[model samples]
Target: MKKTEPHSSRSQQLEGAGLGFLIGFAGLLAFQLLGELVVRLLAIPVPGPVAGLLFMSVFLLVRKRTKASEPEPLLNASSLLLAHLSLLFVPAGVGIMTHIDRIKDQWLSISVALIIASFVTLFVTAWSLKILIRFMNKPEPE
Candidate 1:
């Protein structure tokens, strides 16, 4: 009789994880590409990556409503991306360092603007949230 090797659960899990990562990465790239195309074609003010994220969000929302299951590939990919999210800031940090002299020259103005913007954003967000909650929680007419 020929002997057969037993299947290992750990190997299966590892394979699934690898595939999920690939799928997730591919999805992110695809969305970014779509975003770039849309921005270029429409001359939209928003950045390509930001547009891509909006597009992806709409796509996911539609998919969530239409499909019974969650998007495993996108979720897995996003999780992987989020895990090393801080790395994305490295380039921005480097760019800021390169512009250190310019920043130093306008530091006071920039700091004041940033602080004002932060307060404005916080107030607007809070006001909007309160309005939305009130609208949503209103009792329906009998």
Candidate 2:
């Protein structure tokens, strides 16, 4: 019987992460394509990629509920990427640096828009969750 070396273990870990990333990326692309198809078929206004993310979320939820024995390797990979996700936005931040003047010109309006949107989103989310909880807690009629 042969034993696996320590370096081999490290290589396997890297391979796992790489494979996981590929799986996640493929899943996202497939979701986006399906969403785009559905949107086009239904004449919906939402962007395909956004719908894809929603689809992916629902898939993940269903997988969690039904596939108890299968470990979620892709989800773990996605979460690992998310954990260090700020690095992914560094290029966007750098690009923003080059658009300083344009941002300055529209800073006030942009800031106001962000503030309003943030508040509205916060209020709506809170209100909806509260209503949902109240409805859930209500006793059924006898």
Candidate 3:
């Protein structure tokens, strides 16, 4: 197909966005790997990805405090990720496939456990939020 000026410009913008997304993904992956290394070396019981997330959070916090402006490309990349967040479940779906036999064998127990756990989590979260709201709405003495 022959390129029109506007379409060509749009295509160039998409390519640039893709490059930016790759850069952002690489940065995130680097932090996760770094976290995994730290967790493995230190023998921490927590998940490596959770540690990596904390590390990333701290880095973003510091970046916010120190830099006058954050990287726009990363910001866009993050938004793009969040916009299509369900795609992140592909890994979990694949993992289920990998362990399909085990899951099938214990499907009933797994379903029950998941249901109970979900209700418990929902209740706790709601209770905690209610308490937080009450705390926030309380009047303080001068």
Candidate 4:
């Protein structure tokens, strides 16, 4: 067996991470494209990115159900993205700034809507997670 150099292992890891990031980014773009097509074809009101998210979620669930091994590249990519998730909100922050005048005019409505949406999102997420946990923990029938 050949002895591995310390720098060689580190370089390999960096290369793997770089490849994982590219693959993950590509996957994201492909899903978004699929989402855009679905929305346009169906004339749906939902955003393409949201539709793409649903597609990815379904894909993950199906893969899990089929006992298919999750790809490390995808996982690594997702982890890297999630690690900097706060950065993802920067665009939305800039968008809000652009619509400052409109938001000011509709401050009350916007505030109420934001509050209600937040509560609803939190409640739904909690409920779904609870249900999923229960399902996962269910005992197998003998």
Best by lDDT: 1
Ranking of all candidate structures by their lDDT, best first: 1, 4, 3, 2
- For the record, the alpha-carbon RMSD of candidate 4 to the native fold, in angstroms, is 5.9
- Across 34-86, the per-residue lDDT of candidate 4 in tens digits comes to 99999999999999999999998898888889976886666677788899999
Estimate, for each residue in 14-84, the C-alpha lDDT of model 1 and write its tens digit.
Answer: 99989988988899999999999999999988989999899889999999899999989888889878999
By TM-score: ranked, best first: 1, 3, 4, 2
Which residue pairs collide in model 3, if any? Answer: none
Clashes of 4: 0
Candidate 2 lDDT tens digits, 50-138? 88878888887888899875445566656776898899989888898788999989999999999999999999998887788778997
Segments of candidate 1 deviating more than 4 angstroms: 1-8, 127-142
Error of 1 at 142 (Å): 26
Better of 1 and 3 by TM-score: 1
CA-lDDT, candidates in order:
0.90, 0.82, 0.86, 0.87
lDDT score, candidate 3: 0.86
In order, what is each prediction's RMSD in angstroms?
4.8, 5.5, 5.6, 5.9
Poorest lDDT segment (10 consecutive residues) of candidate 2: 69-78
Give the clash count for model 3.
0
